[model samples]
Target: MDYAFAGAMSGLVAGIIVCPLDVVKVRLQNQPPISLTNYNGTFPTLVRIAKEEGLKGLFSGLSPTILSYLCDRMLWFATYESFKVAISNHTTRKLDDPFVHSGSALLSSVVCVVGITPLWVIRTRMMTQNTETIYYYRSVSHAFKSIIKKEGLTSLYRGLIPSFLGIAHPLIQFPLYERFKIVISNYEHHSKLEDYNPNKRPELSNLGILTSSIVSKFIAAVITYPHEVIRTRLQTQTAPLNKNFSNNTSVIPNIVPYNGIVKTVKNMVVEEGWKSLYKGLPTNLIRTIPSAGISLWTYEMILNNMKNI
Candidate 1:
C-alpha cells in the first residue's frame, strides 16, 4: 500500500514537470516526413508550438498524462515490490541481484503496459493534435469515445508490441540502479563490499538516487528509443479523408497508413530512412532524464518515510 501510494505521488509530480518536453517530443515524432524542415529540431519546435499554439500548447494532454501516471505508477511499484518480496522469500539468491531486479522490473512492466496502454494512446493523440491539422480529439473522454466509435476497440492496443519491446528499458535501468547502489555502499564503507539485506531496505541518499536514475534512464532510453517512435506513430494514426481522391489516384493508393510494428518499421525506413526511427531522441532525453531521476528519488523518499512511520 505504501509503495503504491509513493509511486503514484512520484509519477504525478514527474509527469507535470516534464509534460512540455513530452509534448515537444511527441510532435517531433509524429510530424509528417515532409515537414521535417519546418519544425527543424527541438528548440525550434518548442518555439513554433509556443508561438502558434500559446502557452497552453506546451501542456496539451496533461489531464490524461497525470491520470495515466497515477494509475500506471501505482500498479508498477506495487507489483514490483510484491515480486521482489516473493523472489526473496522463495529463492536462495539475494533480492538485489541483477537478475532478480531485472526480472521483477520486467514482470511489473508487463502488467503496467497491459493496464495503462489505452490511456497512453489517448495521451499521445491529444498531445500531438495541432491547429494546422484536423483535431481528432476535443478532450480525453471525447478521444476515448471517438477512437472506439471510429477505429474500433483494437485501435487502443495499436502499439502493444512495441510497448512490450520497451520492457528492455527497465531491464537495463533497474540492474544499473542496483549496481550503482552497491558501488555507493562500498565507497561509503571504505572498500569493503557489503551484502544487501532483503529484510531491511537500505536508504539511498538523494544525490545517489538522482545520479543513478539519470545515468540508467539515459542509457536505457537511448538503446530502446526507436520503439517509442513506432509506438507513438501507431497510436496517433488517423484515417485520411477523400478530399484528394479526385486529384491523384496514384498518391491516394501510395499513402501508407501505420499498421503493425513490422509494417510500420518497413514503411518508415522506406519513406524516411533509418534515421527516422530516432526523430525525437534529443527532446526525449531532456524530458526523461530529469523526470526519471525526480520520480525515483521521490519514490524512495516516500517509501522510506512510510517504512519509518
Candidate 2:
C-alpha cells in the first residue's frame, strides 16, 4: 500500500483503539458544570456514566470520531511528507532532521483543520446530547441526519473556529517529536538504532524519542486546552430555552450566530460564566496526553518505515 494509505489505515486503527476514552472525555467536557456536591473525581464520574449508560455509552461517537481522525491524520502525514520531498529538492539537509519533521507536522495540521472540523462537530454533538433524545441516532449517518433535520446542515459544523484553533496542538507537537527523535538518534550514535528495525520490532528502549514525545504532548495539551473547551461547548447539544428574549421561543437548542470567535467567547462568558469557558479542561488534558503520545510515537515509526521502503 502507498504511504498515505498506510498512514490512513494506521490512524483508523488507532482511532478505534482510543475511541472509548475520547467519548468519555467529550461527554465530560460537554456536560453541564458538575456540582461540587455531586461528584468526587473524574474517574468516579466516568464510572457513573458507564454504570448508568452501559459499555456502549463509553464508545458513543466512535464512528464519526474514527472517520474524522483517520481523515485528519491521513491528510496531515501526506502533506507533511510531500512538503519534505519538495524541500529536499531545494536543500541538502537530511530529511529526518528535527527541523524537517517539525516543519512537516506544522504544515500538515494546517491542511487537516479545513477538512476535520465538520466531522468533529458531529462527533462531539452526538456524544454530549441528552441520552434520551440522542437515541434517535441508530448509526453515525442517522445521528448526522437527525442533527441536520432539526438543526440544519450547518449545525454539524458548530465548533469550526475553536477546532481550527485546536489544530495548533498537533502542529506544535509533531515537529517537536521529530526534533526530539533526532536528539535521541544522535545521542545513541545512530548505529544501534540503524541495525534495530522499526518494522521488525517495537523500539521501546528509545528513551530520547519517548521523552521527547511525552514532553511535546504535555506542552501542547496544556497550551491549547481552552480551544478544547470552546469546541466542546459549541458542539454539545443544547436544550432550548422556554422563552426567547430576542425572538421566538423553542424547546430545542436553537442556533445562535454568536458572530466571530471574539463574540463567541464573549457571549459564552457572559451567558454561561467565565468558568464555563474552561469546562471539562481537566478531562481534556488527561485524555490528550496518552492519545497524543501514542499517536506521535506511531507516526514516527510509520515515517521511518516509509523512508526505508
Candidate 3:
C-alpha cells in the first residue's frame, strides 16, 4: 500500500508534466523512417503538433497516459518489492543482492507488461491519431470500444510481444537504481545501512538518487530502445482498411507492419536500415529519461515522507 500510493501519485505528477514530450515521441516513432515533413525533430515535432492540432494534440493521450502510469508504476513498485522479498527469501542472499534485484525487476516487468498492455495500446492509438486522422478517439472509453469493435478484442493487446521484450529496460534499470541508491546511502552516512531509513529521510541523499536514476534510466532506455520502436509500430498498426490495405492507405502507409520482434527487427533493418529501430530514440530519451528520474525521485521522496508521517 505504501509503495502503491507513492508510485501512483508520483507517476501522476510526472506523467502530466512530461506528457507533451511523450506525445511527440510516439508520433515520431509511429511515422515511417524516411519522412521528409512529418515529426521531423523533437522541437520541430512539438511545434508541428501544436500548430496543426493545438494544445489538445500536444497533450493527446494525457488521460490514458495518466491511467497507464498509475497502473504501471503502482503494480511495478509493489510487485518489485514483493518479488524482491520472495526472491531474497528463496535465496541465501540479502535484499541488496544484485541478482535478487535484477530477478525481481524482471518478474515485476512481466506482471506490468501483461497487466496494462491494453491501456498502452489505447494510449498509443490516441497519441498517434489526430482530428484529421481517419479515427480520432473521442475519449478513453471510446478509444477502447472503437478498438475492440473495429479491430477486435485481441487488437487491444497489439504490441504484447515487443512489450514483453521491452522488459529489458526495467530488468537493467531497477536493479542498477537499487544498487546505486544503496551505495550512495552508505557513502553519505559512512555506514552500509545506518542512513537507510523508511521512517526518515536519508540525509544528503537526494542528489545522489537523482543522478543514479538519470544514469540508470538513460542506459536502460538506450539499450532497450529498439523494442520500444517495434512496440509502437505494432500498436499503431491497425487491421486492413476495408479489405484493401493499399487503396485507402493511411499517412504512414510506407511503413510495412511486421509481427514478431526478431522478424520485425530483421525486416526493419533489411528494408529501412538499422536506424529504423531507433526512429524516435532522441525524443524518447529526452522525454522518458527525465520522466523516469522524476518518478523515481518523487517515489522515494513521497515514500519516505509517508513512512515518517
Candidate 4:
C-alpha cells in the first residue's frame, strides 16, 4: 500500500484504460494531413485499427508505454516526496508549507521528465509507425531493438529536444495539482463534523478522487500546452542521424539544417506555419488530463491508505 507502489499501479491501470486514445493522439500528431475521417472517437479509432490491422495494431507499443510509465511514476512520486522532505529539513515551516510543497513537486517533475524522455521517444515512434509495420514489435525490448537496428542508437532519443523543454510539466503540473489537492482537502475538513478526523478517513470516495484529478490535470495541461507542442515536433523530427553514415557529409542536407533548439522552433513556425506548433493539442489534452488525474488520485489514495494502516 505504499503510495509509490499504489501510484505505479494506478498509473498502469490508467495507461491501459486510455492507451487507445494515446495511439490516436500520436497518429494524429505524426500524420501530416491530421485527418480524423477514418475514426469517430477514441473507441472508434480502436475499432477501425482493429478491423484493418488486427488486435496487435490496437495495442502496438503498449509494452513500451507500460515500462515508461512504471519508471515515470516511481521517479515522479519518490523524487517529489524526497525533495519535499529535504526542503522541510532546511526550513522552519510545517506540513502546510506552500513553498516547500510546490518547490518539491516542481523538482520531482523535472527529474522524471529527464529520466523518461528517452523511453517516450521510443514509445511515440512505436505507436505512430505505419500500420503495415505495426506488428514489428513484440514488446518494449523488441521495439527498442527494432528502432536501434533501423534508426540507430539515437533513434531511441529522437524527441530529446522537445522532451527536455517539457521539463515545465513539473513546474506547471505539480504546483497546480498540490493547490487543487489542498483546496479539496480543505473543503472536506470544513464540511465534516467536529468529531470527524480526516487523518483516519477511509479510502477516498471515487467521486472525490475523480474531481481532484480532473481539476488539477486540466489546469496543468492548459498552462503547459505550448511546450507540449514544441516537444512533440522535436521528438518526431525526421532529421538525419548525427553519426557518420558511410562518412558522407554530403548526404546530409545543408539547406535545411536541424541544428539548435531555437533554429528548430523558428523553422517550424516560419516554414510550417504557426498552426504546425499546435499540431497535437487535441490529442495532448485528451491524453494529459486523464493520465495526470489518474496518477495523482492513485498516489494520494494509496498513500493515505498506507498511512492509516
User: Could you arrange the candidates by TM-score from highest to lowest?
Assistant: 1, 3, 4, 2
- C-alpha root-mean-square deviation, each candidate: 3.9, 5.4, 3.2, 5.0
Q: State each model's CA lDDT, in order.
A: 0.82, 0.65, 0.82, 0.64
Ranking by lDDT: 1, 3, 2, 4
lDDT score, residue 52, model 4? 77
Error of 4 at 93 (Å): 3.2
TM-score for each predicted model, relative to the true structure: 0.91, 0.77, 0.91, 0.79
Q: Mind sharing the TM-score for model 1?
A: 0.91
Query: How many residue pairs clash in all the candidates, one count each?
Result: 0, 2, 0, 2
Residue 169 accuracy (lDDT) in model 1: 91
Candidate 3 lDDT tens digits, 85-191? 79878987677778988999999989998999999998888898865465767778988877676668998898898898888888888878876777777787788
The 10-residue segment with the lowest total lDDT in model 4? 247-256
Measured by TM-score, the strongest candidate is 1
Could you tell which candidate, 2 or 4, scores higher by TM-score? 4
Better of 3 and 4 by lDDT: 3
User: Compared with the true structure, what per-residue lDDT tens digits does model 4 show for residues 1-309?
Assistant: 264687687768777866776777776554433333434445566677788768667777787788778778877777777777688778865444668767787687767777787788767767766533313444567666655765568756655766656666566666665555555655665653334332242334666667767776776676666666565555555445445344321122223344557876687678667776666667667887777667767777778767768
Give Cα distance to truth, residue 194, candidate 3, Å: 12
Candidate 3 pairs with clashing backbones: none
